[model samples]
Target chain A: MLRSWRWAAVAAGVAALVSLPTLAGALPTRSSDVTAEELRDLVRASGAVAHEAYGESRVDLPLPDVDALGDVPELLGSTTRTRTAWRTPLDWRVDRLTVAGETDVVRAGALTTTWDSADRSVTRLLGDLPVRLPRADDLTAPVLARRLVATPDTVLSRLPERRVAGRSAPGLRVAPADPAQTLVESVDVWVEPGSGLPLRVEVRADGQRNPVVTAVVLDLELGDPGARRTAFDPPPGSTETTTQAPDVAAEVDRLVPFLLPNVLAGDGRADPAGLGTGGVAVYDRGFEAYAVVPLDRDLGGDLLELAPPGGVFATPLVTVLVGRVERTAYVLVGTVPEQVLRDALTALRRDPPPFVGDR
Target chain B: MILTELAKLVRRPRTWVLVALLCALPTVVAVFVAVQEIAPRPGTGPAFLSAVLDSGTLFPAAALAIVLPLFLPVAVAVVAGESVAGEAQAGTLRYLLLRPVGRTRLLVAKLVSTLAFTLLSVSFVALTAYAVGVALFGSAEVSSVSGTEFSTADATVRIVLTVLYVGWSMLGVASVALFLSTLTDSPLVAALGAVGVLVASTLLVTLEAAAAVQPYLPTRYWLAFIDLYRDPVLTRDLLRGVGLQAVYIGVFLAAAWANFTTKDVTS
Candidate 1:
């Protein structure tokens, strides 16, 4: 009996060793009895959750070095590990975890505070702007689901259930009704069943076998993390500064910027508030979207110079184009195909969106 | 039996040599850093090297980071690989059995001694680096990776946690080497086998092609100790790292025990 016990222990040890990776994700698919519409509803309701999670967001776009955009290249090219605590959309904290340190961004109401550990500085900005560069939170499953699931022009279906972040999550696939309207082929998302928060999200570009962008919650726990976790206090000796920061640098006279048309390339302005400051305009069709922004001469000129021999930055997932109208450098960037950008640029040059900012 | 094993380990000249070597590396690194005030650029080199230049109180963490990748694990593998096989190779295993110590008890004692050696070596390195650091760079209140400066008390807590975490990580290596020691009569073969596992793990961890198995690899979370310095602290990877090491220790120790007890004592 003792000898048999030793053998039993050995068997159990091997079994445990073998199950580590299997438990991670390699197990057979879990059954899926839920419908696409139900999964979509669950995602929408995930916002009502008050929980915290640790996750990693990864975006791999092979774009050239247009370094002026400030971390744009890195955000689209590498992995970002994030620990997020959310009580509400208005109150949350996202700590970007790095190898040796962390940089924290805390939002309490309309105030956003950024604390940099390496530089020991604190910067406070009032108000959250709608038109800001994409951040780690933007790529997370919940946020991406919120954006991609709201479209009526996509055909939704239930995907096979699978283990995501150790949770048995049901999957949903959103495929565009018209593939030509956008570069996105499909988006697959897996959500936490209890709270309906997305555990993993993958964006697959047209004709691409692998996901162009993927975000996953590696670990998760539900329930309010308390106010202290979401709050921020400037450490003593930190160089603190507050600024009335504009969402985007409106370098040019707002009134002199071009007035974007109500519809361009068969897509209406994405922002319900309409175009602002002639500096930025977004157009969306279904789940497909693109943004046109006018940057300062130096930055725009650099983008123009970096444009490839064809003068258009093109990739499977993202495409960029720069056109000069007299001295203004207009940037056309989107997740749509390059042809859509070409048409937009031609329209801008010929029927040019009139400079209507002049009061 | 355990106390005897501990005494034997403590009395070994080779054990002291390993501890001294581990302690000496950080001293040399600290000297260069102190004199030249040059460290690898932030985020480019090892975890805490760049920050150590600004304040020396953090040198223990920096030292741990320097040895963790290779030096410390190699030292641990040698000691653990020798735990069983060295006895067999020296023709002492038969005598040890005749003394009537149960094979399971002997294995347990050896494991305990190996654990003691790891803690002692790691602690000596940290303590030496602390003295070297405070002497050369002064014990200025250290700034955390998150750009926050806490009291000296907080820094000490973090450094202590780092040492414990590092020692825990080394335990996984020792477990593997000990298991291999049960398989071979040659200490060199056992040590090399353990080192072989380490080399493969380290290589596959950095290779993108090995992404599927990377999470289960033994070396995956060796650096998660860095997470302790974060402002609110990210415990996700830290917990996972510790749990992974525990699984490794459990699986290998059980296998080692089962094999050693039943094997023929031909050596």
Candidate 2:
């Protein structure tokens, strides 16, 4: 009996090792059974739950697992990850740049403080929100699901069920309806069956088996993070800077020297791009989307230093290009290929602009 | 026996010539870059070469990048190929066996000497390139791909890590040549055979039809050393390269020992 038990243990060990990659969480309990419309409603409902909060919540956002050969679209400066833990409607703590660098941000009531560990300086802001535009990591299931479902020319389908964040959740596969508009093939999300909370998100480009991008909750426990209001206060020892967010139009006038002409939306209408709030130009074609942000003069030095001086700064999802035409620094951030960004920038450089000299 | 093997290896004029040739390639590249009127497009060459052209302090890493594919492996192949097979070709195998040197001891000595050559050659190239690069371009802070500046001390640690990772990667090439050296009596044939295997693996990796076999190829993960330049220092591929090299070393050295232990030395 002892010998049999040893053999069984060995078999179990081998089995576990063999299943390591596929065993990201619990195995699938059921096949995809919902229709496309039901899947849409389910995702929408999940998005709602993501917005609702009660107790303290802590979420860890890891960098997407990009393949070595770069088969997926990702973001620039994405080597860093973030952990956001918030106590509903009032107190919060967000640790950003945990992987690439060190930064700590805490928010209580109307006061938000950010501490940059690199220079050991603190910035205090009295604002309605924690940070500008709510960091991508802070945008939980509701925001992301709504954005994805609202995408034009998309094909949605139910996927095989899989356990996500230690709970069994039904999964959905979302892909571009028109394959020609984008290089991205599909995005799959696994959501909690009851709350609609996103448990995991995976993106597959072309036909690759391994995901090009993956953001999944590694662990989750819903309860109080245990912090007094004092935890949100900025440390007294560090130097402080009080600042307000910059004006959008003033930023656009300062940074954008020229704009790409004849830009069109996915619906085949001539919708020339314009600088939106925060000096960002959003471009969308069906399920394909990208954003171009004009950089602040102060931030250019560090961002440009790391990027290839005259070339594209690439991550798995996004490619960023910083270039100067007529001494104005322009940055293009997009989910598009490097070549596309390069071509856009090159075109802008060649076209002689009507000199709306100095705002 | 190990000391004697090392002495014998150092005594060979060809070994010195190979080291000089290995060290010279990067020196020439550095000089050319320093004198060029136009800078090569950034991100065009190896991971850090474009940056190295601007900041001479990073030249050692850039040199490793430029040489890793063909030059470094060729140097390692020649030395490893000659480890055992050169003795057989020169009619010295019989003489060496006539001594009380055990076969395992002899094999171990040869491998150790070859690995020692790899260490010296890689270091020589890195140091020479760095020196030439600094002379040509002024030193500056090391910038990571992830948009961060590293202090001199941090960058030095990374450069050291890069050198060691590249050295570790060459173990795969060295093992292949060592294994080939055992299979043949001609050092040239062994060296060429190893090179041929590497070339074949590189070619196979590019073909879409051969996708199934790419991961298993010895040449598949060599360039993964570039991932070291990233913040958080991408280690997945680096670890894979190191792990694969270890496997190759284990298998090839076992094969070499197994074949050498029972073989009759008639030369």
Candidate 3:
């Protein structure tokens, strides 16, 4: 009898362990888990404003069960160890607007990017791309939307079987490839059966239940896919202006006079010590007079991006924009001349940043 | 004579055992924490400490909570119930009473000794927990769920205050046990009876019908320890815990003294 009781206890423990994954798999799914065509149809039915340009698309991603890499010391003198990582779900909002089907992308707010379909080029219209946004920082909806569309492929997976919004559906669990360093781990989006529309989205992380972002389509409008093509047009008053070729020697000379005067007059340093370091480096990337004034911090990064051609005169520092391109934004700091600044910008636009190739 | 008797009482084998147990508690807890740290699935040390504090504080406030309704009161009862009744059961009470010392003085010394041991034990637990936590997790800033972090200095102060508050919470249990001890000649009977009261209170606290009565229960003050960890500190809860403990201590001591002086000791 005692032996049978012991066996029963062991069996119960084993059964419990085996059933945990099944229990976890029993979570809800969203309408987006259905076919892409069905989802498009549901969106069309939802009475979403047709052809009305919405620059910012806010997508709330609910990820449950984010896998976090566990801290395990490397074994046998190796610097890597195999360990089960910590996993948690995450609540994420992506605010980027997709301009229908022109292959053109525009991200507004901090770290703006504009894709010019005519030139078949992507432009960092504002701030910087691939820049890490600090937690809780307010960013424009478009910027977040781009991030959502550009989510790592490894994080996207096939949907799981579940019920969502009173409908049977499948859900997808999205996670970064490297479980470690994942800010958001598991987001389960449940797609409506047959319609392929997203009905519910749940995010979980670190064994804590996070809030879900759910969207229900009340109406759908599918316009003529071909008739509503968007045409790219530059602003009415914005004119295309071509600048003169760069003169490396003359540009360098202009920069030296301006930089030397400020360095000598300043309080021992070019910028504040704790804030960050700033320096200028000239690269001969096939361009005549390309100058790169790299700011060590983000505060001045935006200033350098938006500085006018003559010079940006912020207190304690000034920078003159030489030229701008899709990837490269060139600036000369101190008392550089207008011609020199224009020349440097032209060179930078032509030559491109050295790290552009790696990116 | 009373002072001499109390001093001699302090040197008794049981008294030294209690002190040694209290002192050794930190080491044992440290070992347990270290083992957990080295385990395959280790919980975050700081998080575990916070959870322990939460459990400790919330449990006493609501009788249905885990700590006060179960573990803490039982621990207090076990220690306090063994005090006078153990002496009586060991045939030492006759010798102790034959002395010129008054019953009230004897009871006072015993109560003081028990209270001292309780405080020492709590302090040892906290110190050991902190030391083990530091050794394993390193001395870093403790971050709360709200994202606000406490520096090492603040964390230390908070931990000390938490432990002291919990000690006062336990005093209520100790008084109940002491009172029960006076009624029983058999140490086991006294200990079991004290523990039984704790178990019954826990059951009563859990019952739906007794839910309204829970606020008045002695175990309700257990969560008062959490007041120490709050940012501005909730002095109201701490004051209430202290006041309730004072009442229990006073009432139980009075009852014990009255019973010892009047009751027959011919067992």
Candidate 4:
């Protein structure tokens, strides 16, 4: 009986040992707490724009050096693949500029200059041009900062203790085992010991010895931890106009077939009939394009409009427009050529508007 | 008494089938994960199980969700409804009730046995899914779509909590089945009636006119199982889910007792 009891006890002890790891693993671990508001403040202090005017910026180009793009085998089947191996051009031209300040203002010029928003439209301004602004909505800086601070506990476990950029930092390195993988090659970030802020970020590409991308802060100011103040004012002599341009479906039909098939395929084929009342016409050299669509009926009367003729074009490129009709506001996007946009407007003759009613 | 009833339940072919079906779900999920792993594509990886779990937990918890309204609740209703009614139909309940067992004790035993079986079914689902997940998708860090990572430890806790939450969710279905079982002589009628209630609640939730009444409906608390996935966690919803389950269980048990005690068992 004594021996049997001892054997039972031994078995129980072994069972407990076997279950320990699983039981421990099933317990939730506390993560470093950081709120979204705190993250927004950190971004502001780092001079990184959190939310800015304009949507996400995209640059699309054909893969450089490749003679012919071929069909690549996917898990499902063969898929057509196009390669564009071009770096972002270092130089860029500004097409239109709008600045928000203590007062609403509008300015237009080839060089840096401030214009009054009172006139409610682009006006030629005298004196030296204002400072050239950086591209809006770039994710590089914000992504780098997020990697530094509040290193999500999920990714923290995979990191090893290491020094980065002369600071004692947690090294959480991720590298895709496969070379063909495009998501990420390797990510290395260094967090400051004192403030938990990321001091340096390095990302290495598949075949590159040196990191293909690196971002480090030149300086940081942890000032008043609060929201930034914003103010808008219109410039002198600027008049708010209610008369929006009428629909131009005929012009859109004439242009889509010639320009679309080369850039976008599949469901991207634009239906010319969808263009409704109120459109803009741009004329450039000889190529012409126009677009018109209904406004969203929700935003009442106020509308913000911007025209960036020199913006990047991805596949299925569409023009964007917003306005209110009958207490409803809508946003319409259409395609226009980079060059010859102005000349296209000259080709269209004035005619009775095409679309009417909310139906 | 409950243990005796539970033992008899385990002997049933249907109970074995439930266990087999529970085991098969993970195997199917594992095969899918293995296929994706062998030939990975953009936005495809081992996290497929997590995505399925995220979506599955909600539908199961909200028994009136699309899937449950159509089929799953009916299946649950059949199992729970037949727990007592089927035995009675087979002439076993009359014999067993005469074997020195009190009426209240028999009802209690039936409810407990049903609850135990349901718990076992849910546990099998959780364990098999986790085992398959670990085998097919290497035990790597779990990354959320929001780019947040969950360590192996955190993932385990989340999975377990999710399982417990789903078990609580099924209690309401079991209770409804028990109540319906007391109402009818035919097990099939009881099962169909329970499923009908579930379907009606689902339809009510979808109607714009009934939108205001949806939150008060017992079915609303079903997807509250997902409260486990919320970072920082919302204890209020979890508590409310449990409270709602308790209410359903109590009401169903009361109705079952009142009806079973008074009804004549001539059939």
Higher-DockQ candidate among 2 and 3? Answer: 2
| Best lDDT among the predictions, by candidate number | 1
Tens-place lDDT per residue, model 2, A46-164, is 42231212111122222233332121112221322444454544566555433223355666678766765434456776764211333433433333455566567788888878876
Tens digits of per-residue lDDT for model 2, B77-128 = 9889988899999999999999999988999999989888888888888888
Q: What value does the lDDT take at residue A117 in candidate 1?
A: 68
In the order shown, the candidates' DockQ scores are 0.48, 0.02, 0.01, 0.01
lDDT of each residue in A261-323, candidate 1, tens digit only = 767756787664343434577888786788877666687788788877766878888888888
Of 1 and 4, the candidate ahead on TM-score is 1
- The TM-score of predicted model 1 comes to 0.88
Listed in order, each prediction's TM-score against the native is 0.88, 0.57, 0.38, 0.43
Best of the two (2, 4) by lDDT: 2
Please list the residue runs of candidate 2 whose C-alpha ends up more than 4 Å from where it truly belongs after superposition.
Answer: A1-157, A161-170, A174-359
Candidates' interface RMSDs, in order? 2.8, 11.9, 24.0, 23.1
Query: Which ranges in model 1 have alpha carbons more than 4 Å from their true place?
Result: A1-9, A20-42, A160-170, A192-195, A243-267, A271-278, A322-330, A351-359, B88-102, B140-151, B265-267
Tell me the number of clashing residue pairs for each predicted model: 3, 8, 55, 51
For all candidates in order, the CA lDDT equals: 0.82, 0.64, 0.43, 0.43
Q: For model 1, what is the alpha-carbon lDDT of residue B191?
A: 85
Residue pairs whose backbone atoms clash in candidate 1: A117-B146, A117-B147, A255-A357
**Cα lDDT for residue A291, model 4?**
37
